[model samples]
Target: MIPVVQHQWKGNLAQAREIQVFLAQKVILKPFKIKPETVLAVDVSYSRFEKCGYGVAGLFKVAFDNRRHKFHIVSEQYYTNSDTVPFPYIPGYLSFREIPILLPILSQISERPDLLLVDGAGIAHPRHLGLAAHLGVIFDLPAIGCAKSRLIGDFLMPGLESGAYEYLRTNGKRIGVVLRTKPACRPLFISPGHRCTITDAWRLIFTFCDQYRLPEPLRRVDLMSKRMRKQIEKK
Candidate 1:
């Protein structure tokens, strides 16, 4: 089981931002090779019933066969819990609102993944730590953040052709990439979370993209989370 550091979730906005600033310092940016046999992606879906909300974390794994240079789903897991959201929906502090729901899912996974991908920003955040970076530091796992929209940083839109990209720059430093995963589709904001550099994260995301705009493992978990919410709501 992956060890989860014990931390409280309830806090005010100032307290939440302070924690992010502290954890942001712990994020590491270094080059590392990421040939993985297993990769995991996680996402959470929320539904409300009266005063409480149900949050379900959908964790999906993809295994790569080196010989074939292909990837396929190996397993999927889901963990659900209901609670009033402890933190308000504030910019730059999403991890505080979402991490509590995801930790149980991470701890209960059948196999630890070689890498973890999250559907949010990493070091590309205003505080240099988003959901991916936060979880990566807490777990000390190799993680990457692939966000659908720009959270911070300036970038020129990448070319329409798939695989095109432009660096996301902040004060002349490249913090992430605006990666075009499919022709004519909006680019993904890619950033390193922990234990990997920007280039390492880019290459891994490109390899797993295959025929879709989003990486396969990340896409799978997103769908899984959305479907889980639908099923739960129907009951």
Candidate 2:
């Protein structure tokens, strides 16, 4: 799918920061009421030696099974793209490096995703524009950020039970939630990227998770991107 909002991806650090600031303003945080029937999750794996990025976009048809009373993936499709990354690795500006490869993979998927799940930060970043938020605004879709680690927030550890979560806040304002999707596992940092409220982000992710810390869509895409990188490394 083509981005509704278009902008150049290559730039210097200063220019990238400026673009993030501009795009961050466009991110809308509100309650997404419609239950997502389809979700597109994306992840990028970088080869340090080759300076290449392998991006994978997984489209999953989701539904809540009445008997199970939980969300499940009904069908899935995977698309991949790889290219030498032009931008160097930077702590806050990951979208600049990853989005170029990811956009192509997104375009390959014919289904329109009801939601976009990203393995990175959202409004939780210092600039309030992380990879998920950037892509969310570009595609004009509801999106959520589910990062494995905290980027810029402090929170008390949530209980060691599934579905337990704590408010992740910065500057006394709630930015996201640190949630434990499984018992005895490290929690994930979840935030609304665009067109969704924090509660919506939390509920969707929690419902989508099945026996894993990462949501099903993200877990599948993460493994796919890693496999793509491994295949290139073997060649």
Candidate 3:
């Protein structure tokens, strides 16, 4: 079981790095050599019009032998944020507001996923570590950040299909990868959150992708979060 430790603050972003280091130290890090049977995609969605937001997280169990990959999604957890908005959408300090509600639901899932795909930049941040790395360090789960757009990194256009990937560097470290998931689709920025190697991150991203730039698990989760949030507000 992954224990979650979220540091609350009085609207301060200064202590983010310290708290991240503490969380990274709290968990026992491991290097899993591929062979992971299951992968989960996590994402949060919000409507600025409604001034509301929600997160959707789930386990997408993938079975592989020597031929093809099969996926089965199970136990998706969805929830809302603390009604009162704490801060504006700051680039590097997103987890502060979102994870507070998301983590609680994530903890209740039965089986901890072998890999996590986050719908945001991972180590491709100004600090060389984004929220994906933060969650991976905190939970000790292998994770990859799959951002729809570039947060911060240098890369060549990896083209519009699988197998094309470029390295993303930040803080003098090759911290992220930009991969093309579909033909003629926008490429995704991928980075190691923590524990997982950069290679494994790319494999997981392609494993879950099915005709979309974003993986299926996270795409479903994002849709779920948006729909659920709208339903809650309507209620």
Candidate 4:
């Protein structure tokens, strides 16, 4: 996949914040018109002591058997570059720290995914541009953010049953949802990144989730990234 917009990844904090504000305007919230047959999930694991990061991108084919959806891995790619992380760990500027490594892995995947599931925030962010929104705008693809924790929002606890969810709002405007993917498990913060609406984001994530707090595709890539980081540490 190629980027629709180009911008420098390395910059000071002020410049980074400016870029987020500028790009956030380009995020398009609409229905994803296609029935996605394939999805690509991307995640990064940092070795802070080594000042390096490992990124993994996995492409999974969506399958339907017995009226239930399943995701099967089609291909997986890892970033093996030795480039030292250029940016420090900051709460709001995650795209700067991880996107450089992830883009290369994304480019390596031969088949373009119908949807992108990111393991981070989207418009739920304070600047309205998080890692998922940034990537979706760059690729011009429909993407969703499935974050493990809330960044900025006020939400009541969802019901204990699976698939239960509550709206996550900021200043009286809904930005995302606090979703319960599994019974009695911690909820996930989900939002539209770009080219999709809030309802679409939560619905898709709920469908992909099975017996786990995270959706299957995202869980796979998260494990892949952590394994890659462990391998590097052993070396």
Q: Which rank order by TM-score, best down to worst?
A: 2, 4, 1, 3
TM per candidate comes to 0.89, 0.96, 0.84, 0.93
Each prediction's Cα lDDT score?
0.79, 0.91, 0.70, 0.86
Task: Please identify model 1 stretches exceeding 4 Å from their true place.
Answer: 2-4, 48-70, 74-83
Residue-by-residue lDDT tens digits, candidate 4, 165-193: 99999998999999999999999999999
lDDT of 2 by residue, 1-235 (tens): 8889997655889989999999999999988989899999999998967488999989899998767556999999899899999787789998988998888888777677999999999889999998999999999999999999999998999999999999999988999999999998999999999999999998899998889889999999999999888888898
CA deviation > 4 Å runs, candidate 4: 48-50, 69-82
Compared with the true structure, model 4 gives a TM-score of: 0.93
Candidate with better TM-score, 3 vs 4: 4
Across 1-235, the per-residue lDDT of candidate 1 in tens digits comes to 4655556645778778878888888888877675776676777656653233444444555676677565666776666665655665677888987886676666777676778888899899999998999989998888999999989999998999988999999998999999998899989999999999999888788877878989887786777766766776788
lDDT of 4: 0.86
Global fold similarity of model 2 (TM-score): 0.96
lDDT by residue (tens digit), candidate 3, 72-171: 4544444334244445678877766566656666766768778877888777777656778777776778878888898897788886656688888765
Q: Quote the positional error of residue 160 for candidate 2 in Å.
A: 0.6
Off by over 4 Å in 2: 48-50
In candidate 2, where is summed lDDT lowest over 10 consecutive residues? 62-71
**Residue 115 in model 3: shift from native, Å?**
1.7
Q: Which residue pairs of candidate 4 clash?
A: none
